[model samples]
Target: MAVLKEKKLGAELRSVLEAAFPGQEARYFLPMSIGNAPEHADEGAALILEGRKTLTSSPLWDYLDGTIPFVGALGVLLDGAGQPRGVVETTCVEIMPFRAVTEDMVRAYGEGERTLEWWQSVIGNLYRTSAIRHGATFTEDTPLIWEWFRVVRRL
Candidate 1:
């Protein structure tokens, strides 16, 4: 229950995140919250709050800390109090076949038409199911990771 305020610079956002999780590291940056506007893109970053390998025999062999690699992350900017304030997120992960399904799906997206449909229909369905039931491992509340996102250099 924190208030994630929008600032004029990436440094503001970075400072907020770094303060919240001192030891965590910001890894990647991407465009976010693009409301169908091809040119409107915002800077986004992710930090692995905590990570550990899942010791389960399911399709997800390891939990990479924070949202699963394929699943779109649930992002919330934290406030000084370490509470979620601002939020940014996508409905689903962009990558597929994930670890459970065949890795070929990863290549299919760019390979051919059949590959795309197979990835969208068959493989996507499988992954959605796996996520819903979470057949792999790890108990409830032990979410892969707590993620955050923000738009930077935006007017």
Candidate 2:
């Protein structure tokens, strides 16, 4: 198995995604492999361009694993030199929305609650402004994970 040496995984991923789609908004979702995770299905991260957080799901906590599920999103902006113009937006989502506090999971993370770290992790990743429509699909404007890795490995 190959190890990920890239310091900024999110930044690197954003560039490749943007290159695949010039002047267009692109989105991606990849599984996050957390080392030393409990016995359960590994969750994934949903990456997308900056300022776009319309695609997201509810907090999904796996009772089997004590570790929290993480979802990440990103946006890549480039200039004439092909360098990073700017990062428009970024977000993260957690599966388990109501497991942080025993006394009041909802109260702790809900609109009005304790407002702890876990709550931020769960709510921050979500896109509250918009919601996923019925029967929607990704446009696949950029190369898939495998394809992008193949080229990068050759470099």
Candidate 3:
């Protein structure tokens, strides 16, 4: 996969957002595929660009600590190479336990046949890995932040 410096990618994203939303306050430009491998980052960005993926889940603690992402936010999706791929606007946010994640929400995620079983298998692994890395515990009761977004512009 192609790679660029994060600073360069951020600058490019800023320019695109500025031109697209002139005179508006700048919005956050975020890299995609947190807690996953580089290839998954590429896949996630592609899914967003194709408009197949609209919802993403993360550990609720991340949001509470202001690490990244929030409701009603705008972000530029970045591929594995750290290239800006598109812009997205968050439309909804929900905080719930992992067990509470609905099949409908997983379907909206639009990954791997969009099945609940697939979501469980994939996200369960991701959460487990992230938990180990962060010294946290992963369980069905683990808090999650589910965010729904819409692609507003493709670059």
Candidate number with greatest TM-score: 3
- Candidate 1 vs candidate 3, lDDT winner: 3
User: What clash count goes with each model?
Assistant: 5, 9, 0
Q: Against the true structure, what is each candidate's TM-score?
A: 0.23, 0.19, 0.82
- At residue 80, give the lDDT of candidate 3: 68
For model 1, residues 9-62, the per-residue Cα lDDT tens digits are 266555544454455434312212211121211111112111111110113332
- Poorest lDDT segment (10 consecutive residues) of candidate 3: 1-10
Candidates 1 and 2 compared: the better one by lDDT is 1
Write candidate 3's Cα lDDT for 6-62 as tens digits.
322356667777776666544554545433456867887887788888888877544
**Of candidates 3 and 2, the better by lDDT:** 3
The alpha-carbon lDDT assigned to residue 112 of candidate 3 equals 79
Candidate 1: lDDT over CA atoms? 0.30
Give one digit per residue, the lDDT tens place, for model 2 in 36-59: 122111111111122112222232
Clashes of 3: 0
Any runs in candidate 2 off by more than 4 Å, and if so which? 1-11, 24-32, 36-96, 100-155
The TM-score measured for candidate 1 stands at 0.23
Write down the worst ten-residue block by lDDT for model 2: 146-155
